[model samples]
Target: MFQTEYEFTLPMGYIDADGNLHRDGVMRLATGADEIVPLKDPRVQSNPAYLIVILLSRVVIRLGALEMINPKVIESLFAADLAYLQDLYNRINGNGTRSLKLVCPHCQQGIEVELDQPGES
Candidate 1:
């Protein structure tokens, strides 16, 4: 058996007519659930986001499992899921414009620190 819980609030923003940010409002995201069954397939593990979002929709919206498994949801799932994946990729590829590791000169011990910019200490 597997179980997890998450709770957070999403702040709302607006877009101007020219597509600029408008700081305002607030929104809440919440979920409550009991037991969760784990997905046991190795192939699904490779791209687990699709399965994850389906599970989320089913549990959050109380929608039928079949509706959560529909094609349109899966399509939206990929794009929605890519945000985190892309952040991971950027961090790995050193494209994050920040570095979290530094080396000591004398002892050569690896020190972990975050650099604000490419050349920042």
Candidate 2:
């Protein structure tokens, strides 16, 4: 069976109220409702970027010792960490993978490469 959720480790990590660090977490595949309803949110309406925050908050079921997860918590993540999460989301939900490693037939060298998305110039 295909996996519906994936685990990731944050680079900077999230700090809880008592000073605990939360690096590991799980994010489930977003449902249709998850993506659509957030559009109605005033915050999302005012700022499209906030849509990721709200969507992630809904799908991220757990994060280390945190008792609850919410948009505020997702908003508090560092920019790099947040970008990492976004990449992870795209990798899992968009095409099931990001990059591939292959050996050059002529040079016998191995390299990792990412496929360009559609509409890229």
Candidate 3:
């Protein structure tokens, strides 16, 4: 079966107003509309970086116990967590890959390695 959603854990986690911490979450592949619609938003119009917040809110289906995920929620995330989500989004949305290519410092040989999220076994 084809998979469209991915699971992730924030590096620092999101803390709610009640002092609850949310670490685990789910993000789905982004659709064209997800990328396009946010462009029309005043926030995105004024600050292009705001696009990531809007874009993420649209694709992230779940986040711990939160009943809803929105741009405000995303804005509240720690910088590290927000970066994690961005990388995850790019990987699952066909904008990035799991493998990274590198050249050995000593041997000057090229090699490719697969990347694993922090907690994955």
Candidate 4:
């Protein structure tokens, strides 16, 4: 898988009594190409809020910044990761779901359908 690394400096104002933010003075990290591409695209790059959310997620995961472990944050992160994975899978595999399973709305019986090959007619 392709990957890229980026370094960013946290501002001084974020330091707190608990500890200094980045006592080492530099934060360097790697993210998958799939994750970085969307952020780099000019169409979406101008939005700082989305960038902040992505940066914070990376910081939280890389720095192990849990003061008190919140399950919701963990769940949110997991969901974000899963969404990224699903996007990557769709791009690489040519479609999102390889197969579909259908069940009766009332009785919940299992049904299965297989997707066509990548270039199949």
- Top model number, lDDT: 3
| Stretches > 4 Å off in candidate 1 | 1-35, 41-43, 62-74, 77-121
Evaluated at residue 83, the lDDT of candidate 1 is 46
Global lDDT for candidate 3? 0.91
Tell me how candidate 2 scores on lDDT: 0.84
- Misplaced by over 4 Å in model 3 are 101-110, 114-121
What's each prediction's TM-score? 0.23, 0.79, 0.84, 0.25
lDDT of each: 0.37, 0.84, 0.91, 0.42
Go through the candidates in order and give the clash count of each: 0, 0, 0, 0
The prediction achieving the highest TM-score against the true structure is: 3
Task: Residues 1-121, candidate 4: write the lDDT tens digits.
Answer: 3222222233222333465442112222324643565587453477644543444344333323445322233234434443543343343345466677989889999989777644454
Sort by lDDT, best first: 3, 2, 4, 1
How do the residues 1-121 of candidate 2 rate in per-residue lDDT, one tens digit apiece? 5678789999999987788899999988778898899999999999998998998888888888787899999998889878888877777667456578999999989999886443333
- lDDT string, candidate 3, 1-121, tens digits: 5677889999999999999999999998888999999999999999999999999999999999999999999999999999999988987776778789999999999999997543344
Q: Once model 1 is optimally superposed onto the true structure by TM-score, how far is the C-alpha of residue 86 displaced, in angstroms?
A: 14
Q: Give the lDDT of residue 12 in candidate 4.
A: 27
- TM-score, predicted candidate 2 vs. hidden true structure: 0.79
